[model samples]
Target chain A: MKRRTVGRSDGRKVIVAAVLVSLLSFGPTVRRSDGQDTSAIDRGVRIGIIYRPGVRPGLVMLPRTGQGLDSVRVIVARDLDYGDRFEVITLPGGDSIRLASTTGPRRSSAGGSTATKGATAGALNYPLYQALGADFALDITAAGDTTVATLHDIAAASVRRSVRVQLPRSSDPDFRQAVHRLADQALQAAIGTPGIAATRILFVKDGKVYRIDQDGADQKLVSSTDRQAMSPAWGADGRRFAYMEFQAGKGWLYLQEMGSGKRTAVATTGSALDFTPAFSPDGQTMAFSRATEEGTDLYTINIKNNCCLRRLTVGRFSDNLSPTFSPDGQRIAFVSTRPGLPQIYVMAADGTDQQLFAPFDYGVTGASNAPEWSPDGQSVAFHRDVAGTLQVFVLDVRTRTVRQLTSVGRNEDPTWAPDSRHLAFVSDRSGYRQLWIIDLDTGRIRPLLQQSGARLPAWSPRLSEATSSTP
Target chain B: MKSVSLLLALGLGAAVFAAASCGGNPAPQNTTPAVDTAAENQRVRDSIAAAEAERARQAQAEAERIAAQRRADSLAALARAGEEVRSTLAAMIHFDLDKSNIRPEDAATLDQKVAILQANPELRIRIGGHCDERGSDEYNLALGNRRAQSGKQYLVSHGIDASRIETQSWGEEKPLVDGHDESAWSQNRRDEFEIISGGDNIRRP
Candidate 1:
């Protein structure tokens, strides 16, 4: 993997540290980031890249010897890059002897495996790294049934954090996530910020739902191959997701627990289409689109209570669908065809005060669909048809202005990452529909999954380390 | 119940190939028999009107002669109308891009469907709405739903029982033609009427 310089201008983006009051209701008590801009709290981190690039500490990955160690180095570097917090400096190679343990022998309790000596400093050339513009460096060493990771602060020349991670076998399906978990830990120790590298994404490909990593590795089937699944939505807890399965000539929404793969049909009407299920950030409610003989309307059900199915927008011969909840769960941003063509609309969470949210001319613009609200509650990402092709666009909620993100081949279905600075969307730039991620801060676009036919990607929240596996 | 079982069986077989549209074969278009229009009936009506004028001039045997001519015109209209019942039940009406409301041009076709359903009380139909490949898949589904509903609403508004018509949206999943141009899209954005039951003893409405 190659490392690029973080240009100064591209590094500035809106990031707000929203303190979500873990309340029982849905109306937003969120302390808006844009409202707090220019206030006294702007001294430190805002999301990932809002900090001054000058203060961005440089980092490197030291090479080591062990079976399957090379794959670890590659994945961890990609993870660090995706984290967007570290100024990752890629070295040609590190001394292999630096892998040997310098600390005295100790039992490894992490993997519950008996092993000698954990991670410690060997022959680290700190001065050479400092001259090469690196402030921190990560080193991984493996010996006697244990893989140990050590983070070093180049300036202080001291070990910051060290732990022995019992990595799953390279052939196991959980191997990639285990390594990502390490990268998340490294980020926390380096900057005291939660990293989204350990998170996974859900997308629909060829009529089935699939899960992929943030860096485009470990693409696996999340829904059954026998059942046709589309429009996957992730819960904030990261263990539950909802999707629509086409069965018996109708589409129905089903909620699935990833661990047991137990899918229970959610509250929806029979003989009607139910799709695009979006769980509120509070995880207490779910909003979806249901089409009846009358018209297509937006509805919400109390997911936690399994009752209180409330209709939000009355289609009245027009369509209101694709509901994405704001971070505070107080408002929902959805696509409404009430204007004769689909446009982004926002409404209160309790189904009131509906109005057009995104700016567009009635006759001058094309149809916009699939609007997703960022976790920070600042911007909404969506795709609109321009001329003949569809392109991704971002709408800053405060300014009410729109910016086109992609102008290449047709791009649609923009989904925001937990970090709020990255988005995963379906783009046909390569001639086939695939999932792509764009960094809003740097305007960097990369493919999240190489698998063709991927569509409707939904990024998950920062997953905890214990549940980092398929569940 | 029978209609539900019949469609479920057909959907299972098609679902596998339809979702995996890997360019093996072009999609099969809506093939249900349908009458394009009752042009033959229109011409017959004109002739009947002309005969009435002739009968008025010849008042000697006016009653008998006019009755005989009236019977002949009735038979001709019945034959034409019967052809519409069997073939035109699955007839499709086109829609504009992203518009679900029925177009003025498609009104006459839907009116004919209303007549068919009225004449046969037991008749049931399924209106499958479709769209072109231009829009997003999920959005297209909702649009297609409105398209199907629009056709149903038109029939229901015309006095047909709402229960007799079932609506489904194929979205952009099933296209009648394979192309990216307007020609293919115009054909793809349409509502197809399929008979679910009561077509055995066809009769003119």
Candidate 2:
């Protein structure tokens, strides 16, 4: 039985294993091609720790040479670090390079050679950084409202990729965003997957909806102050999102377009309460919960035409809410109280084959709710009221096995990133309510936002590629 | 001049007669009646002055009585409002673990809310649903909705107009208690009635 299980698990991770195998070979081949250190394999292992459980790509950021782009360099470094797919390394006082004065007095070329004078502080010391053991080193140069990023494979001793991005000098936000895009492109060249550093997380803080950058910068209020907003769900188009707002003691589902900042409330019949709106992957349909005098149940609305309203669940007196759709838009997992307690349930997009999903005893594992289907559709993450407190748990859809992800404080409202490798949830483990992210591969958990009182985080799809402003 | 002298002589004869009478001690019987009449007039004037003072005092007491009655009516109105709030508070219905059905023990409370609504015809209330902080936020919201709907249904069954009652689910956001135990959970999972309109119409019996 153990052998069979091992084989099945290995088979599921064939793609990840293949990538690791190729990376391991690439390092040695690059060394051989350079003829610099044939016996340096052992040194490579000693200098830099590599091959983690799931290998996070290693990157080193070199000192930047620019005029008035010190802030841009910091933005790029921070973006790459927050990507979570890379192991970013910075030299001692290396981060201060971005904070240093870009307009200081120049060195006197009369005292020495011009080349020596120009190489005073911000020159690339390749050998020293190469020994520091990074797979790739990134060099950024800013000149006249444009920045160029060059990724050099350290072992191969060759330039892997170079990308030049033009930024608007009038706006600091646009310039920083351009730098983020540059860093993402460099990471994509090193690894096959692009970074989500340019994306935004929409959440509710202090009863108002807000949007913040992935690195917790530039926090902006997105919803109206007249009402309390909750459960923000980003649309696939990256420009639109839907949230639940309470006005005049009634809940209304409103869709907000970020470009125009125009909010339109969904038109539904009756005075029934509507909330927890989730947009389909294609942004055409929205699945939400409606509580009427009859009961609370899951329903989907055709958001484009504002017409086809279809009820998904038939809970006479029970409640079915918090619907999350699969990446393929074919299945939806939601919380249902039909069996007397809230439990995760999965059904087809058309509301067929509805059945209990998680394997739990009545009072043993507690009740489960807030089901979020991962972008990869392999697992469903939800919080269970277990052992006297709520904890986050991920249930493998194929194996029907559940694993607890959080052990500290009460963790709830787990939402996935675009890569499906990380999740942002709410935890009071730090003695206050705050947003936290847990990397599944590395088993590393960190606070996402420095400002507290954040909840119900919904990550937007790769906004760098989808947003018009990003180049 | 002769007519005038004749008239003056008659006046002088009357005056001499009056002066002779007033001066003579033997005329005491005639002067005694005049003295009695003067005393009678002074006594009548004193009686009129006392009657006027009594009328003024009566008017002042009547004004004070009216002002006191007005203050008492205002206090009674305030007490009526307080009683309305107390009745609605007493009508708070709590739920078991995850169940939304109205409990039998809470039926009397719901009945009280229904009575309050029935008494004040224009009064409208919002049934706010709540939950213990032990579940997902979105799920708790749905559970709260069910709990509130259950409370509203009970009120409707007890002859309250459905239009007069609205429902809101706070989920676990607004908690009556904050402790992480059954005691707090029990109090937290309750439906509270908030008077949204027509509060002024709540009158005391």
Docking class of predicted structure 1: acceptable
Candidate 1 to truth, TM: 0.75
Over A1-471, each residue of candidate 1 has an lDDT whose tens digit, in order, gives 222223333322211111111111123222222211111111111213222446567677764545557788788877887666665755333321222243423333321121223454644666545544567888877756677778888888778888678988888777888888888888888888878888899887777788888887777787864777789999888888999887766888889886567788886544588888999988899999998876778899988878999999888867889999999999999999888788999999988999889999989899999999999999999989899789889999999999888776888898888889888888777777887777676555667765677888889988775556554
Assess chain B of each prediction and give its TM-score.
0.60, 0.66
Off by over 4 Å in 1: A1-56, A93-122, B1-86, B200-205
TM-score of each: 0.75, 0.79
Model 2 chain A poorest ten-residue lDDT run: A37-46
Query: Where does candidate 2 stray beyond 4 Å?
Result: A1-54, A94-128, A465-471, B1-54, B57-64, B67-71, B74-90, B118-124, B161-164, B176-185, B196-200, B203-205
Displacement of the residue B60 alpha carbon in candidate 2, Å: 5.7
Please, what are the lDDT tens digits per residue for candidate 2 over residues A168-246?
6736545545566777788888886878777788889878888877776777788865577889999987888889877
For each candidate, report its DockQ versus the true two-chain complex.
Answer: 0.47, 0.52
